[model samples]
Target: MTLTFAAPTPDAIPLHVIDQSNCDAWLAGQGEQVSQWANRNGFTGAAGQTVLIPGSEGSVVMALAGFGTADTRARKRFVLAAAAAALPKGTYKITSGLTGRALEIECFGWLMTGHTFDRYRTQSPSTALLVAPAGIDAKRVEVQANAEALIRDLINTPAQDMGPDALQQATEALATEFGATCKTVLGDDLLSENFPMIHAVGRAAEKAPRLIELNWGTSGPKLTLVGKGVCFDTGGLDLKPAAGMLLMKKDMGGSANVLGLARMIMALNLPLQLRVLIPAVENSVAGNAFRPGDILTSRKGLSVEVNNTDAEGRLVLADALTLADEGNPDLIISMATLTGAARVAVGPDLAPFYTDEETHAAALFKAATEVADPVWRLPFHTPYEAMIEPAYADLDNAPSGGFAGSITAALFLRRFVTQTPYMHFDIYGWQPVAASARPKGGVGQGPRALLEALPDMLDL
Candidate 1:
């Protein structure tokens, strides 16, 4: 469910945010009884700790939350959830401290805690509401938080309920909301449309393999975004282990994240010709499944040898990226849960991205640092170009030896995208553990970072 904001009522409780250094001084000003209460409870103001003060009639009068000091790393985003989870059910207002982006993060955190995917079961909606803090843009916080909720919901859904057809429905719904146009090339039509690689990877699935395209905006620079939308990957003939297949439902997280980004852009009315290409498919096993060692031609007309059927994300992405590249837009971004090597390199929290453009690199890092959505840059490494090239075809879907697997995967995709400033993000998409505002489920990797960087990159 979407979390919304409203004006504070008289019954709203005041949430006082404090740090270890300021705890003693602030308690002293509250008089002896309040100071004694804090001392008795041993509330030294550690981060993520909350204390609810009670009134004479057995109702909560005030609440105190610890923001901690600069050394606490995870204390950055969604810190206010501690108070939200601890307090009694009621409306709340921040009485002091926290302004600008910090305040926005706190408010957003409260909403995030309320977002739970109860598709199979029902969850009690959170009555603990947060009134938007002073000097903060309430509408923007609501939009971004709702967008994040949408991403998580899409990612958390089971593959049975979220195949290529379902992804197309989601895309079309988003288009309907923004008055954009959406078209789909499905089933055997993928071959007629010259997207052979996409069809090859998804021909065995129950749902038809398709490409979902969305277009919005009439003026300004052309911006194309491509997302790898492999709805469910059983690894085709190559196959993954039982454990690996467990989380395959989240394989389409790239599409979910980009759609979330698109929602934010359109809601805010960013001036640009926005185009989104999602090659939605499911790699299932059947009599007709594409086999290993098969050579498939891409929309770019470059033949790729499928060394591993499990490496299907790139096969589908190659065709979609080629289509986006044809427009020669100012910038093209491809986000995907493409490789495990990326997780081994930087883990899940820090998303690994590749781009040779110096200006784009600088802007990406700056935006990530500013918003606390971390991303690390991996080199395009021309030396690794030879790794993706096998003797038989123009590219090898899976390189041998697997020594820079992520880099080689990026290189393979880089072949499809020529010039026009391309950026590829090898994202994990799934949050292994819960941290601050981010729950332990499907999460948006680079959307916030890109959102912060795009306006400046486009000179808007």
Candidate 2:
């Protein structure tokens, strides 16, 4: 809600957007004095650069911003982010040509430009404001920004403040906001509720683990979402190196992202019966911590042999996905910051998702392109199914060979959803380096693109 649309005012400053292809023509249109001033200041319309023109009075008149060349690869989305961040703190109106998706990206960028994790800081908030562009939907921009900001705030919090108990509280708050029905199976109750895998993974943490569920909407195709909420991953008894554990606070990014997407869906009142399942737990070290070589029974009646306790996200998710599958929902989507191998495969910018259904995969790919929220489709690759099948149990939490880690992880999860059409996202939720619109911290991925694809996928 921090970003708003208002009627134009006489004092509102003008903002011009131009790229390399049109820079010369734009310069020619400007008066000779203005062109000379811009030249003296070295503003040739390179992306991320900005220059402000001085008014006759001491106050500002207008500003110019760049969007790179028409062929620039970075122009894929959020091209106006740099301008939003670089402009002086004042009311401004985009006065140049920007329309359709491009204009939407501009408005989204403007709202996101104000996001900052100032919880423990003394810095002041952003003062920049924008009057909505002519054809843009300001309400859509506000809702999307709020959802993303919630994800960032939740993930950026330290594990001390974001454990299983806290995660359940966050879910409850969201449910309350939307008037959705909320329920939980906590601690030993998980065992009674047939969520033994979830209990096993989180048994060692001081804060007991729980299953968080929310139901919203009443009359449409059933859609279910499962998220792995590993509140803090200490790699269980296997343990992680200090460097490997640095960003583990964001291990629960799957839950955060699902909540964000849920926010958008509910706010827009999309016609679908929505169900969200999150298994909130912490994989910490203790004498009782589940260890490698242990056999655990899952809710689906399949046994999982723990090849590595660090592979706990899928263990928790197995139980949750089994619950989601029991309903035989029309579609199921599971997201997790599941594997380091996924990061190695696609890097941090692009999320790799696995699906057995070709039509669903095609729709997701097309939606990702349209929204510029990057996701690459990795196959279910039925050939790799054997890799996770150890002789001792129905599945191996971690396979012996190091190759195809992300695919094998997906296969391990695929077993729990036997009937529901399923899609899995292996996401690295932390941004290692900050970009124009993306801050270097916990982030939300895949959901935006998934939301874009839903209407078509559901035939709504």
The Cα error of candidate 2 at residue 7, in Å, is: 5.4
Which tens-of-lDDT digit does each residue in 334-440 have in candidate 1? 99999999999999888899998888889999988876678999999999899999989999999999799999999999999886789999998998887776778
Per-residue lDDT of 365-413 in model 2, one digit per residue for the tens? 9988877788998888899999999999999999997999999999999
Q: Candidate 2: which pairs clash?
A: none
Off by over 4 Å in 1: 55-59, 74-76
Model 2 stretches with alpha carbons more than 4 Å out: 5-7, 71-77
